[model samples]
Target: MAGGLGSKKVDITWSTEESGLLMAISVKTINFKDGKTRNYQKNLTNRRGDLLMEAVTLHRRFPYSVLAAFFFLDAGAENDGTPKRRSTFLNAHARLKLFTDRSDPAGREEQFERFYLILLEASPNSVSVRPFKVGDPDNEVSLSQMLDEILELVAERNPDFYEFDDGRLIKL
Candidate 1:
């Protein structure tokens, strides 16, 4: 949907549960803080893509265990600090799988963990967090920067495993 001149369509992607890597990570950008949600579905969906790319790249270098970390982060299964949905943003949901590498057992577990850790670290300031409050200190921290840091940490710890965007993960 376009709002006016120079406007752009909301980006989106599709995925499923049987994919066996990760699911979705929707990210929403609303005008004001509490206005209606537009492209809320796209937010999580694209974020999922970011995570899937990270895990697949890593699978070549690291063990399944390591890759799993990123996979789960994308899928949204490891929820802890995630935003609590209000009636306003509830209908804006979108779905996307983490990755479709559901062929191996070890590989699946690695993906799960990958999804888990990324969410654990990135939740506080995530786009999802916007529904709750407004201004804050940590909110200023860029999500892309955070993703990059996490990717670097993963690469540095497991040098023999995985590749990311310049050692950076794209934040949703």
Candidate 2:
């Protein structure tokens, strides 16, 4: 499929007879040192490119597939209340906007069907997520919405697939 490009192992993938390859999701996690701005920026920049390039390469071959992304950032708290961290966070997201529907996304790699950016703080348990758009970072998407997108796609493509209102999958 995908124009005969050798199979690329995505983080998640699904298919249906009607849709061929229907979905692909890739997840990447990066560590950021709040105290080490330079290293954090460099690593974030490089890693973002590494991950986005994979999606880009795949989407070019299968534009109809719902390409999704999940990015997790684990950052120390050395600059919590400081401007540096804010600037860096926005910058990272801005650069990331290149491959997402949130920003200028129509040059080569089309917009992803959905994109999520997650931030994990120094606290072992503190985590946050946001759609790839601007103006918000602490917001997280509900589990229901995530499942709905997937279920709806399946229901539309496969006669043997049925999804209940509560997101249960039942094969007909």
Candidate 3:
């Protein structure tokens, strides 16, 4: 995608809630003649509250460029010297159950679809998604990856939920 004619490649570097995860995304938008590049958005936090939601919006024009938007949670910056806390036992259990559920395919599918679409709506040219990987629950995960995992797990639990290939959400 890089070093190509009429290829719009964007590179961005941003952090996640936990100190361990950050994002470096490169998206290529193929236009008619030329392309553009820019950093979209990034979040840095310690996993104490809701993570920031990063999105991109494209301008309405030929060879349109994109802009990144960061949606912060009620909690502020991760390095704001705030003490870290753990989620309640029920909250943790509920999340796990939702991910592991295999019976309610419709519900899981709906939840997953909504989650990813929200991200897509926020982003300008989100042609693909990357799942987040964390060694531990306390570890920070990339916002992109976190959303990706939810999409994957939902599809795994219920094949009919969505039609995505290789992290790229497709119309199937």
CA lDDT of each candidate?
A: 0.32, 0.58, 0.27
Q: Which ranges of candidate 3 are over 4 A from the true structure?
A: 1-137, 157-161
Candidate 2 has an lDDT of: 0.58
TM-score-based ranking: 2, 1, 3
Q: Write the per-residue lDDT of candidate 3 for residues 1-172, one digit (tens) a residue.
A: 2211322333553322322112223322211211231112121122212211111111111111112222222121111221353322212223323222223323322111112111111236544322212113233446666446544543443344335468754433
Candidate 3, RMSD to the unseen true structure: 17.2
RMSD of each: 13.9, 4.8, 17.2
Best-first order by lDDT: 2, 1, 3
TM-score of each: 0.28, 0.65, 0.25
Q: How close is candidate 1 to the true structure, as a TM-score?
A: 0.28
For model 2, how does the per-residue alpha-carbon lDDT over 47-129 read when each residue is reduced to its tens digit? 67666666667766665556677766654321333554454556666667666642222345645656666655645676654
The number of clashing residue pairs in each candidate reads: 30, 0, 8
Candidate 1 global CA lDDT score: 0.32
Model 1 RMSD in angstroms: 13.9
| Alpha-carbon runs more than 4 Å astray in model 2 | 1-6, 32-39, 75-87, 102-110, 121-135, 150-172
Candidate 1 lDDT, tens digit per residue, 1-172?
1111222222322222323222222233322221244222334445555544554444433332223222112213222122654221222221323343233534542242322222222445563421111112122334455445445544443444444566553332
lDDT of 3 at 132: 19
